[model samples]
Target: MNHISLYAQSLVYIVAGLNHFLNPRTYLAIMPPYIPAHQFMVTISGIAEIILGIGLLFRATQSVSAWGLIFLLIAIFPANVYMATSAKFIKFPAWLRWLRLPLQAVLIWWAYRYT
Candidate 1:
């Protein structure tokens, strides 16, 4: 993989991971109701993001991390869908909510590139 791509991906994940803690409520709000233990799941996913982000920085772990991120993206996709469908629950504009759907695909592709 290109150094720039790897660096960019690492940065995105790290920042996002940090945001999970810095703004846990934002994440908690978007979570679907069917998923139980919202707080616990949010924190666990945040920790996973941090560890995966750090792992991406190392050559030995890059592939594993990339795969992990792809899995993470897939795993959390329902939240994206929930955000798009349940627009009233989110504070963002309708356009932004709809955009998240495609953005999830982009993120998945981005992580797949690393693998």
Candidate 2:
């Protein structure tokens, strides 16, 4: 990945990870029904994002971090689907919820580039 893309990816993950703690309710509101322990899952994923984001900055860890992020994206994909399919559960507009589905794919592809 180019420097700009790498930096952007890192920032995205870092900021998002921080947001999980700063605004856990937003994330909790979207947690799929099938997923257990919503709060724990959110916190764990937040930590993962922070670690992966920092890992991406180093040459030694970039590839592994990218793969880790790709796996993380895939793992969390069900939440995206749930959000898109169950718009009534959340306050977000239908368009925005639907938009997130494709954005998840883009994020996966972005992370894959580094692998």
Instruction: Give per-residue lDDT, candidate 1, residue 93.
Output: 83
Each prediction's total of clashing residue pairs, residues at least 3 apart in sequence or on different chains, is 0, 0
lDDT of residue 21 for candidate 2: 100
Runs in model 2 with CA error above 4 Å? none
lDDT of 2 by residue, 9-108 (tens): 9999999999999999988977999999999999999999999999999999999999999999988989988888985556778888889888988999
Model 1 RMSD in Å is: 1.5
TM-score of 1: 0.93
What lDDT score goes with residue 113 in model 2? 88
TM, every model: 0.93, 0.94
lDDT of 1 by residue, 1-115 (tens): 4888888889888889999999999999889999999999899889889889888989899889989999998889899889889855657888888898889889888888877
Provide C-alpha RMSD values for all models, in order: 1.5, 1.4
Q: lDDT: which candidate is best?
A: 2
